[model samples]
Target: MNAPDRFELFLLQDGEKKITEKIFTGLSNTSDFILLKEDHTLGNLIAEHLKQAPHVLLAAYKIAHPNVPEVMIRVQTDGTITPRDALRQTCQTLVQMYFALGREFQKEFALRQFADQGDQGGAGNAGGQGGPY
Candidate 1:
């Protein structure tokens, strides 16, 4: 259902598939708790990374049903940031880290290539002359 004040909670079901959506107005937070889903890897990954965010007091997922692959996540912040914001920040940080790691790897690869060329006696001038130009 939709709330006038921006906060709302509702359930969406399609045959055997169901999802509970929770929305918080003040913090502008929203999350979906999935039930009977075959894969909970994305929820678990988000929980793992959201825990490292600043002001995040708790970020975890749980399996509520033993018979089904039901998973729910509760992300809490210290009033400084919304749970959605925290998760967004965490994802941004991960992207930044991934780029930084890629840059580092490129640098290492370039250095290794230079070393290999040196070992192959290609350190001198490109021409056949061994001149110090």
Candidate 2:
């Protein structure tokens, strides 16, 4: 089922395989999450989400708003954050929130973070020194 939206959610199932995909045009708005098909691998959907997000809000934010604390405070206070910074922070926070909610966006966010961590070349994998591993 196709709906007029920037994002659409789909699901596929085949024998013992099941996959879910959520597609969106941009990263700044809410759209319908359609459940599509019955059985298939989820590779396509994950790829699509990653593809759209970066070119749209994701890439823009990487430079515009790179700080998480400032973004968080700005979001809560609605204070004097620059337009670009505000937009970037908003987009990033929105994607993160959606993932936390276990929405279709989770896959895309997870994949992106995974790639980012890899790019960091295992720099900060270690957790809190105060805690046991």
User: lDDT (CA) for every model shown?
Assistant: 0.63, 0.34
Per-model root-mean-square deviation over C-alphas: 13.4, 18.3
What lDDT tens digits, residue by residue, belong to model 1 across residues 1-133? 6543322122333465544545534343434445445336656776888877778877777876654456776777787887667767877887787787777777766776777677895564433322121
lDDT of each residue in 74-105, candidate 2, tens digit only: 11112243323443554476567556666434
Angstrom error at residue 81, model 1: 0.8
- How well does candidate 1 match the true structure in TM-score terms? 0.52
The worst-scoring run of ten residues by lDDT in candidate 1 lies at 4-13
Total clashing pairs in model 1: 0
Model 2 worst lDDT run, 10 consecutive residues? 68-77
Error of 2 at 130 (Å): 32
